[model samples]
Target chain A: MAILITPETKIIVQGITGDFGGRHAKLSLDYGTQVVAGVTPGKGGQFFEYGAHKVPIYNSVADAAKATGATVSVIFVPPPFAADAILECVDAGLDLAVAITEGIPIKDMIRVKRAMTGAKTRLVGPNCPGIVTPGTGKDSFGGCRIGIAPGYIHKKGHVGVVSRSGTLTYEAVFQLTSKNIGQTTCVGIGGDPVNGTNHLDVIKLFNADPETHGIILIGEIGGNAEVEAARWIKANCKKPVAGFIAGATAPAGRRMGHAGAIVGGAEDTAAAKIAVFKECGIEVAATPSDMADALLRAAKAKGVTLT
Target chain B: MNIHEYQAKALFEKFGVAVPKGTTATNPEAFVTALAALPEGPTMVKSQIHAGGRGKGTFTNGFKGGVKFCKTKADALAMAGNMLGQTLVTAQTGPVGRKVQTIYFTVASDIKKEYYLAILLDRATSRPVIVASTEGGMDIETVAHDTPEKLFKVLIDPAYGIADFQIRDLITKLGLAGAEAKNAAKLIRNLYTMFWETDAAMVEVNPLITTPTGEVLALDAKVSFDSNALYRHPEIVALRDLNEEDPKEIEASKYSLSYIALDGNIACLVNGAGLAMSTMDIIQHFGGTPANFLDVGGGASKDQVIAAFKIILGDPNVKGILVNIFGGIMDCNVIATGIVEAVKEVGLKLPLVVRLEGNNVVAGKATLAASGLALVAGDTMADAAQKIVKLVA
Candidate 1:
């Protein structure tokens, strides 16, 4: 049982006819995610083909959900319409909407986020690597993946990982897989300034999961999110948590690819966040390799073995 | 994503928020024309730069103010002339200040009470928030540090918007009255509308003023639109003043590389933004200053990798280079091939440290080794940092 998404979850692709959407759809299918349907406006009654697998395309999320029982929505819509697509998915009552689309405007996301209040649907990212529950072989029944991070790097294990950076998630997971310490779930919450899920949100879910023996959090500069999440960990988190913060050497006020990657204040700096993580009595990881060692140590402390 | 004060004012006007009538002047002649359009008496000459604190900042040529209260048209023209070609070093702008290419000329307002107001995303609430204080003429940061109680914030409900009643706290705290309070509430609502419609990340009206004539005005404007949402507003994109930006950054943007120049000796080139940042951090953690932050992105092409190297090497301050690539969406060999190509094309001669992982690592390392470019190989990110720092030291 994974923390956010599982192998059993069926996904519908939003903007599936576009290049990014279409290509990632193929990748997700190859990774064995249950990508059952696609949404492209006025492209209804058509099919998006990735070899013999022809995923049905719908004009709206409503039609696809009605036909395929796709509980999860994997959005690759352009930034302008991405927020509306997420809102449409939420209104359509999808259990989870993973937005791989980066650069959705903050104000637009603000509206989508507001609409999510008390709503049943959970959102992962508007700019993110998405979530993956990697278990066994590359088959629909063996694993779960929702973002653009390379799928083959992940392996099923005990550590639950959440990160704000997409490629770093793959790096951390690859290191874990190399070391024979797999994961319960790997979630890249995204690098946008305003995103749906955060470190604390994923941590809360991981904390409640019995299968996740330890947790690895990858935070970055800009925003006091890591600090806030560390405070939460210090107070109530029951699981062992290892943390890695990016942007430690990042200059202030530089929007580093991700919108939210700037250092807004002193406390949002990597040094500051690492200090907070230390104060929380958590294992601190500086690099991707450091993350693997820290995570395995945490799991060992939690009475688990990698081999 | 940041716009000039005049550009911000243009946005304010579009959103029904009142502001001082101002026109942008790019030349001394335009400055004279804009000054003549103003009512009378003193006019405000503001240097149009992205960073804040222009009123207190000094010019690089030893002039006192980036902002000037010009009593005559000749004075306004002279001030504009003094600013347009020179750099203004504000507290926000480092020692090497930004060159002023435009000046905003506005009619000075009659101020009764100076207040502070800004609308930005409150990450904690995950909602747009309006922060206000009556102590406005000074820095909001100073306000936050000194009198925390004076600062008040209201999270706008996206569904319902900022209700008139929701602004009651600001009104009460600032001692606003029937008309001023009512008008201020309406102003807040309009600002929220602007924030929503423009896909703005932040809109700050420092020294939001109340005139002796019983009117509220945005005395100064600072607005930043979300770069991700720039597609939605091409007009805003058109307002981009590239002259104010770093040439290296501009070039990097053209190649879709996330590059920022820093004052250091070691240039870093990495794949993912997070990894790039962490690589920079480890360099600093190991007592080495990074020259720049360059992210070649996840699926970078060979050309982009070459361009990234060119940009990093463009800065003569860079004495060494560190290439850390963690291949997931990116293949390690692609980076290695690009590095080899860039070295041959540019006659590269810097102490380089290469750390490669993920997809096709062996081939990437093999490619780098075959190039015979005097590159030191590191097994881990930390090891790479230590090696690069040692070489530079």
Candidate 2:
């Protein structure tokens, strides 16, 4: 079983009438994701057909979650209403919510995050590509072409991949696939300052997963999240892990789309993270390809071979 | 995203927090008039820039002589004329810097109470945290490090906002008592209100001082606005000071690309910030250097991509170029087309390596397929980085 989402999970599409939301809903439906409901506030009682199944639309997240019993919510609402939409989902008791929208006000996110602290609900991103479980189906807020990277790259193996960069995750998977390495799950933990599920959290999940033999962690510059995850991996993770920290050449003080990817001072550099991971005895890849190779090496070191 | 001190203080004042009366000055005459309007006493003239560390530099002391006690309009005018349009190079921003566009002239308060306070966006916690200390005026970073317990922090609940009890506790911890404590609490609440209303990423008041009359005054203000929220706040649009920012950064802003100037030799143009920073770090680790950190963003058009390339090449210190693109919604083929056009336009003789992956990788490779340009296309990020490092070396 995967960590958060699966094929049986009923999903609700927030801002379903909007261009971005509507487009991703169609793609998710095409990918065979169990999209049970859509919500666009004023456009309630409308219907969108996916295959033989017809999904009903609702006015609000609470209404949709009540009627459809949607466990997961993918939000495509614009930046302004992002926090409100997520809060509504959390209030509705939806197990997981992923906000595909970018440019959310930091204040609004802080409020959403504070509210989410004790709640059972889990939030993914205000700015991210969302998550995909390969052939079993995918639920992404951002546009990632289906079958772009062969589905065979993700076999139900014992290797799990967690990344801050969505594209890099795909790259790592592509490399692994070429090497005939498949994954139990590949999680794209969006690179937002106030994102839901960090590397440490994902590492904990991978550690607990019996199917996962090794894990590949992809990180970026800015926060000490990667360093913290490395410390956690050293202490808790029983499996061999290979890692790569992005943002090696990024200058300090520049934010690169991802709110979490900012280099305020010298200590937050990518090299510093690499040094930390190395000290923890986790093999560190200087580049993306090296990351995949390092993961393979770690698997070999642990005597877990892939045919 | 960073607004001037005057703009930050204006927002603070609107929320009922007392700030030193100040006006933004575009010219020497306006600067003089604004300074002359302040009450007769030793006035503090602060250079208004988005960056910190202004206090330790040339503009910190106001004029060439000691603290200029402006008794007459002429004295203020002389001070304004000298400071106006003059670049204040500080230890923080380095040489060749921000022009003194606004001079904050205010009455020096009688320091009965001084406290350092800031509401900053904490990345780790992904929340706005209120950091306050009783030992004020000096650097808050110093306070945070030395007497860590002395610095009381309160994580604000976004749904309910800064509670009344939290405000009272913060004031008490800041060594405030009685009516003065209440006033201080009110100021804290007002500051939090201002922080929300202005869509500020950071709002800091160093030395939130109390006068001999027990009046709370924000002696110094520092604010960083959310750039994405600038569309909503049109007033902040006027506060954009191009002179204070790097020319390349300013140019990249025009194309909506995120860029930060760094002191390195290799200019990097990556699709995303994480990759860009990683490339920079790798360059430094391999004994090479990076001149700038540029992220073309996700939805970059060919023109925008070309513009980003041009900006990177504009850096005089740039010895080589590294273009790393992991195409998501943005196609590598689209980026390659822009790179081809950019190389021709800029006539870049500097060694370059292009790492393009995802979304039509075959087509992306085909576009630049066999172009006799000195461009080396890498199949992966490692190859591209290693190639660039070797070429630069």
Candidate 3:
């Protein structure tokens, strides 16, 4: 019942010959993710061997898909070429592409996003921590984690987590796991000016998943996506959602860490978002440390037990 | 990255967008050279800073506004002198406004109507959008607040480009006729080109003016390019005004470290942008002010870590420093060594707290413990936050 990825999700790693890519490819294979192929131009037929698990290399995504039948893609290409990597995955008609690479020019994403409208592939992040869905019981089903998230932090459970921040997502999962509230899936939509997925898109998926009993939405200043998500949470999602917005004390115009995290105006501030969440029947966590507890209360309201 | 008005005007010209001829002046003393580029009659002595609301802003030397219209060269030069080096205080720029190092001396156009027009990324539609309003002089935020109906938005389909029908609809809505309608349409199209081509996050013309002869000109413009996309456009990068930014921010970019100077006491060093922000928010919540926001990033090297501490210690206001790392793709032992090496190199004068979690936590903790440095170790984010706050408080 996990959202996005699962035990059978065949994976392909883009920019596989690079240092980060090669290392993470090993890690993902070790974690039991179904990594079938690797892609790096001019380095085709190169074998990526780590312990007993060995994957074939292809020069192009189309070749990887044609031979290995890899349905999912995780891109680790550098910033300058990340956009083309994403478009390449889309051209190959991957079911989903998780872009682990950060700093892809927003204009490049501006084109990538428009290109994805009618395409078969659904892009995750150009600058994000990818998606993770822990396998239930002893890591049997390949425990679908696509990106560089610490594998130990996630635990298989009913709560689904979606966020724009990377380490903050880990922080929330840590809190949830500590409280014995495991996550069904966690997705980092990203922190760029232009991103692929949003709170509503993830929430819609989580709501339909029977295993996902609750959801945690982590937000920050600079955009009105949280507000729109709050309204959607009220109207559509029957499952209880707990939310946290960072940069409460952040000064206006200063970009606090993330690219999309600047207070635009009155409507885009943290307080305004908190108010909207509260108004939408969402139990809002005042701080990052309070998110897990707030989610517990929300789940309790919905009669779902954790711990 | 926000470019100055003159820089934006140059970009506008490059995209075939029409604007009033303007010349750039570095200092107020260079008014004679600036005025020489302008036609006779009336000219605007506009202060060049990163912020908006400059037309309504006041200078520290008791100058009325950042912008001034003058009929004579001496009057324009005098107005420019009062603002060139003085700090401006705008509604957007708090009490201490940015210093006006550059002045744009441009010929003023005869305004038949003032309109507000901008092309920006619409997050809802995931497309480039043009937001146009007949009400120009007022801030667009104000227009969105007071009369949202007066504002018109057209989502430009990336596949289709800007359509003639969309332009005609916008022109008809603006009550434009004859050559003015055609001119508005052309400017709208050019703005779209500039927005997508330059990878601009925002292309704002606050008061797009129409002359008596039915010509549309961008009277004022403020352009912000996507920081992520700056690599593709080196010319835009060259236009960056380093004097306008914090020296530490510029230095942080060199090491690929994401650091922002804040007015607080607890200097934070953490891994990941999300965790870094949460650290700041938690620090503030515990009644402790954060001195700065510094993220060494996901895959930080030992040298990058050392450089990060140097940048943090560069700020003398920092009373305490907190090192929080939730290692995922990053190894904890590497972070631990980075901390030890950074402290030894920089000579830690501030009370420091270190919190390391995930991937080789025990080895990381052992490394920090054996270092014999005066560092407060925390087992959790909550623990680290409380300890840093207590030390600073």
Among all candidates shown, the one with the greatest lDDT: 3
Candidate 1 per-residue C-alpha lDDT over B1-393 given as tens digits, one digit per residue, 9 for 90 to 100: 888889888888888899988878787667767777777677788988888778889888998888999886667777788788788899878999988888888888889899988887777677877788889878676777688788887878888888777878778888898777777777787888998888887788888988877788999888888787788788889989898789999999999998988999999999878888888888988999999889898779999999999999999999999999988667899999999999899898889999998778889999999997889999888899999999999
Q: List model 2 lDDT by residue over A188-241, tens digit each.
A: 777677787888988898888877788899988777888889998888776889
Residues B1-393 of candidate 3 have per-residue lDDT tens digits of 988999999999999889998897886557898788777878888999988778889888887899988887778877787888889988877776798889888987889999988887766667777888999988677777788778888888887889999999998998899999999889989889988888888888878999999999999888888888787788889999998788999999999999988889899999887778878888988889988888899889999899999999998888999999988788899999989998998888778999988878889999999999999998777788899899888
Q: Which stretches of candidate 2 lie over 4 Å from their true place?
A: A8-10, A15-70, A136-156, A255-281, A304-307, B59-76, B123-125, B345-348, B370-372
Interface RMSD of every candidate? 3.7, 4.5, 3.6
Ten contiguous residues minimizing lDDT sum, candidate 2 chain A:
A139-148
Q: Is the docking of candidate 1 incorrect, acceptable, medium or high quality?
A: medium
| Top-TM-score candidate index | 3
TM-score of chain A of each: 0.93, 0.88, 0.94
* Per-residue accuracy of model 3 over A161-182 as CA lDDT, tens digit each: 9999888898889888888788
lDDT of 2 by residue, B118-143 (tens): 88776777766788888787766566
DockQ of each: 0.50, 0.43, 0.52
Model 3 TM: 0.95
TM-score for candidate 2, residues paired by index: 0.88
